[model samples]
Target: MARILIVDDAKFMRMTLTNILTKANHVVVGEGENGKEAIRLFRELDPDIVTMDITMPEMSGLDAVKEIRNEFSDAKIIMCSAMGQQKMVVEAIEAGAKDFIVKPFDENRVIDAINRVLG
Candidate 1:
């Protein structure tokens, strides 16, 4: 099972993802509320993957992706975006995210993304 870090502004989102990941037998290493925390958690936790929310207070997920990729070229990240945030999702991928899952998250889709990225 892959170790994961979840970063989202919404507590409910984080809990949802945690439930999904845990039920899939993945370990959640940490949770963060924004991009800045995402970066710091990545450094400290060194999880197998990260799920990052596209928009947050301190920094955008796009920026976090860029920063993390800059520091750790192989860091695996997945962007989480709400419906109609397609442009931001694309930008996140360009910034170095491996893949993305749209919200509100679908269980199969989320698992598929994690498996795909891990592979």
Candidate 2:
């Protein structure tokens, strides 16, 4: 189990992710609605992993990835993307996300991605 931070613009997505992580026995350290809060929470929570949506207000997930990676090189980020956001996914990876899970999440994929990144 890992300390996790879930970030997404939609409350439903956040709730869904939280449920999945909690069920797997991971500690959900925090939740955030935008990249600004993502960054702020990262510093405060220091979670072992973060699941970040690629799009959000105030700041984009890509920018947040870069900012967090800049400060914490060991930060492990998993990008959450919707279909047809392949371009943003690449940018997120280039910006320092460790892995990705497509939207309309699959429990297996979500858990697998988290495990892969944590490992």
Candidate 3:
């Protein structure tokens, strides 16, 4: 099981991801509502993986990914984006995200992404 940090602006999204990840036997070590919180929690929790939303208040997940990667080059991050956000998803990958999941998430895809990144 991997330690995970989930970051999203929507409370429901966070809860949903927590359920899926926990059901898959991954420990949700922390949660954040924005990129700023994501960065802070990452440093504090040092989780094995992070699921980050691209559009968020305070800071963008792409920026958070860059910041986290700067500090921890090997940090494993997976971006969560809405459909039609291909540009942002590409940017996220360039910024250091290991993978991405499109929202309205599928539980199987989420689990597969986490496993692939961790694998």
Clashing pairs in 1: none
Per-residue CA lDDT of model 1 for 3-103, tens digit only, reads 99999999999999999999999999999999999999999999999999999998988899999999999999999999999999988888899999999
lDDT of 3: 0.97
Q: What would you estimate as the lDDT of candidate 2?
A: 0.95
After superposition, candidate 2 runs with Cα above 4 Å error = none
Runs in model 3 with CA error above 4 Å?
none
Q: For candidate 3, what is the TM-score?
A: 0.99
Q: Judged by lDDT against the true structure, how good is candidate 1?
A: 0.97
* Candidate 2 per-residue lDDT over residues 6-111, each given as its tens digit: 9999999999999999999999999999999999999999999999999999998989999999999999999999999999999899888999999899999999
TM-score of every candidate:
0.99, 0.98, 0.99
Model 3 misses residue 36 by how many Å?
0.7
RMSD of each: 0.4, 0.5, 0.5
Clashing pairs in 3: none
Tens-digit lDDT track of model 3 for 1-119: 99999999999999999999989999999999999999999999999999999999999999999999999999999999999999999999999999999999999999999999999
On a 0 to 100 scale, what is the lDDT of residue 17 in model 1? 100
